[model samples]
Target: MVEISIVISLILIFDSYLLGKCISKYFNWNADYFPIITIGFFVILGIFEFFVFAFVKFQFSVYYILFVQYILLIIPIFVAIKVKVNLIPTQKELKMILGGALFTIIFAFLMGNQTLGEAAFDSNFYLSMVIENSTSPTLGTINGYTGNIENISTLHGYQGFYYFHSLLLKNIRNILSLNNTSLTPVYLWTSALTYFYMLSDILFHSINLFLEKKSLHTKIVALFFVLVFFTNYFNISFPFYGNTWKTLNIACNMLILYEFIKLNNKKSLFLLTFLNSSLIGFSSSGFFIACFIEISFFFYLIWKKEQNYTIYLEYWISCLSLLIFALLYFSGNYTKISILILAIYCLAGYTVYLTKRFDAIFWKKLLQFFKFIFLISVLLLVIVSYFVRNSMFSGSDSQFNGYSFFFRLNSLGDMTLNYFIPVNKIEFVRNCVFWFIIFINCFQGKYEKEYKFFLLLIIILFVNPFVTPFVVKYMTSIVYSRCFEIFINPFCLLIFYTGLIEWLEKNKNIEILFLLALEIGSIGIIVHNNISYYSKFFIPQKGYNPVYRVTNDQWELYQNLIEELQSSKLERPLILNQDIAVKAYVSNIRVLIDANTSRSAPAYSDENIDAPSDWLNIFYVRDYYGQHIWKQDPDYSKICDAIIDSNCDYVIMDKEVVVLKGDLYLPLWFDARGCSEVIYDNDRYVLLRVRK
Candidate 1:
């Protein structure tokens, strides 16, 4: 498995280098900045996968996709070879790369070795889908609980967004000839490591761009700050166990920012559009973040009076093209109409420019005002239409109830504020002092442009939650707001540090000593927090029990359960507790209940009610809240009879279920129906065979 992972890593690096060189040439960027280009390459690759799955309507397969990629690369590879781009790195660059690699490996090892015993259902649910799709080659795989093929693409919205990660895992599986269960750790580690490495590379490059005179010591310090901030600050809210997609999207956003800062021509427009659209393939929040940033940049350009007609033409063309592609592939009516409106807007803008109407002072001012209004109005309409179409702001009686709305808003507010002032006391004080330095230097006018841009981002994120109640009805406000923070917080920190270093360059020795002391103290706080959190896994800490640790007995018990189920040869759906579904799916067996029921399970027969005899619903609710309402219900016998008459061929009860449902009721209910036989019994679990 390790050898297979190394091979996959090599393939990824080679492909990224080739594709990066081609993209850098197209955009007229220096070939030395191929690492940034590599980030763009992955973004484009994900978008390509989405298009293939969307239009082709076939199951995702690594071999077929790679074949297409290689064929398409022939032209670029030929051009690159003719150009003879230098792919080697200088000593300094190589050292930075190696340093980033070492950090990523250590982080990935920690993340992978952690037990999955307490992993979030969301994480396991996506992993199960990836594993299932690999074997079957279809996104519409049968639901573990209901045995129905679901159109998960439309239901989840993020199904195609993370396909690239799934593709990598599938490739690893094929190369190693390993089963899904054995490769679970590899999947977790590889995905986390790759994303972090890309993020580290982007951060390093962005910092270098900000500070043109890069030094070895400065580079190492910057890398340390980036690693510490991300691992500590982000982990407070977004942990590595369940939020892998979020982490990847955040990194992609930073990559977009790097590109935006360097925008020069039509090629840059294309690259931005491609990268933004790729976010839509990953997560809805990511897509929105991309759109927001693109629109903001558009406004900034117009505000600055960048009268390059070609740039405007390229911008509008990319927007129109991207929306049209989104409409065709994703089948969103909003995207369809967005293209039409954008076309009209672009035409009007072009008319003003072509006619030289902006030559006169009054006319120029008036036209600028009108342009601002037009752009802002169009953006507002798009946002409003999204909420309306999704019924997010329906009514008080809707799922967007008062409690949920308030709770979401509060959570968003807390999270946004926490990003600036961390929850930990020492870190909070250090962050406060750091921000104080930035605030005091805000009036110096040295970084006015950066201040304006990032300040606008900060304001939007801070205000989003407060206004969300009026705009979107049913959506989780925190989720939407957190997306912005995830994308913006890292950039904010980068900008702050960049400004600090610039200040230190000009300031006196005493001022430099004071600032250096503050920064070092901040770094120390972050490192302490990380060490404290990570240490709980090995050495137990008071009031901080590690979630990702399982005992030897529990591991052995689950291994036995998996082995028995695999050899059962049962032809009917196995009824399992919801908690056990992850194990079942990893073992490549079908179960009757799992966490992925939002789109998979059958719809309710009546509104506000579920059938009492529905095994899926019973176990779903039980596992969801860890409560056994089924056993205590007055209609328990009837529900048991219904399940007995259904197609359920086996029932597996773990210790939790046995404790909740009790030995007497479970055994008597099945025995009385004369359809169940005790097959296996142990202290940790019980297995029953249902007669056909």
Candidate 2:
């Protein structure tokens, strides 16, 4: 907990403020938003490094990433010193930091113990990727599940957050002298803190946006309202456990919304474009969200009649270049989506060109026509994707069900209902009823144009399958619920908070009573429903918790296994261990087979074949390595023969299984077929040296 506090403070204070200050010079943003902008900058920098590593083909190490972060850190420090800029946080900034930290601590306490949900889920792979990045020279190019060379561009393009995780994990290990035994807890805590910081920053900035002069009381009140109504009420606990990439995605989208609302100059536009690029590599549906935000921002600019064609051209061109890079370097449906977004930005640039050159009503009409075409194109894409969802995702059927026109329609309807239906725990505030009041308030109150824009976005993109089909899988995917909870829920709260603040301002006499009642009520509900219902949302996670993913015993086994593997004579010795908990820590070693495949197959065997070509290798390997399936203990000679046949240098097995007789154990195999020497033994696991 102390370490978590230190890391969070270091990030919020130094990395966020200083590094943010340096980048803000280039991007030009308010100093108040430096924390989020710094985070956004890191997201972009991390992605840039991801591409650099993938395209340039270099041996990667923790030092490489550390060097990059140090460079970023030094630049800001140098600038602040040279310019004599004050580096200390102001009293107001200190309050924001303390407030955010308090919320984070509360969140951590609520989300107690966690575990990796399933073996085949993306979280397992993401864990492996981070470990690989931390220790292996292959960086993210090698697949942890299969010891095969995988192009990072294909599978890991949108997962740049892994690089960030790798960076933090390495720093923690180096700073604290912790080993793989401490990795899981540290990783979990760091990830949750990072998300909380991003979220808190969003809330703080949002409050200021609404209130003209935000006092400490007002800020705290607004934060409490959002933390309860938006964060606690929404079932966003999945990200805190292991799906941290989604949390980052949600944070990035919130930052995008913030920038979109405050976008008045070229700096905000540049930030938005950079954020869009980062989203392209964030997650599976990252680009879908990016496109939704981009199109809305584009239209917002046009509607405001703030068409500085040159600035718009610069922004579109910047997006165009990044989109083309993503298209060329990456594969899958996202690339296809990128082509569409790329074309839209390109066409938008051309239209801006024509509108600037001709300055005619005709060109303006053409721009309007292009907008309609874009909408129609998006609708057609969704319809086509729906029809071919089964074929396109034949292997990955777990992500989406077999396609039916009626099923798609039913899914959309269900999503609409889910958006308005509050969770069972917080039934007092039905989302539908809350939204109804807010919708009426939008017409009743005097608000900024951008506030209405946010409202419009919630109505259109919150449950619109056609708009977010790629990310939401036509509102049928398991991620659909969590996505909206993080994606649309915050914006809704912002609007609601704005209206509430205005109403409170008009009736100052009852301000304290209203806030006190709401705060007390929200806290009461949270305490009543302390147990998270995230697991029951859509997919049944076999072993899901909100905190530490690996158990103490499992972590001890990992440390022991790693110690033995490190002492081996062979360079990159191949060891075979089927313990699922050991998967996150063994990325540096060459494993004969994936532990995730052996451990998680029973639970997620149906969903294992998400992609035919991709998962067939895993299934084939699992068939041969029947450690879990084959119940009988084989002869010592047979076990030795199996190890040698598989070309594995070492094998770690349970102490109970490697017995020569009932109570006897063999030091070395003495058989004609093959031989193995007992190199290391523990109460739980036995490590054997397989000889050729």
Top-lDDT candidate index:
2
- With a 3 Å backbone cut-off (N, CA, C), the pairs that clash in candidate 2 are 158-281, 395-610, 396-610
lDDT agreement of model 1 with the native: 0.50
- For model 1, what is the error of residue 226's alpha carbon versus the real structure, in angstroms, after optimal superposition? 3.4
- Give a tens-digit lDDT track for model 2, residues 183-220: 64556566666556656666665566555375667666
Q: Write the per-residue lDDT of candidate 1 for residues 137-168, one digit (tens) a residue.
A: 54445443344456544434244534554565
TM-score of each: 0.74, 0.73
For candidate 2, the C-alpha RMSD (Å) to the true structure equals 6.9
- Model 2: weakest 10-residue lDDT segment is 611-620
Per-model root-mean-square deviation over C-alphas: 6.7, 6.9
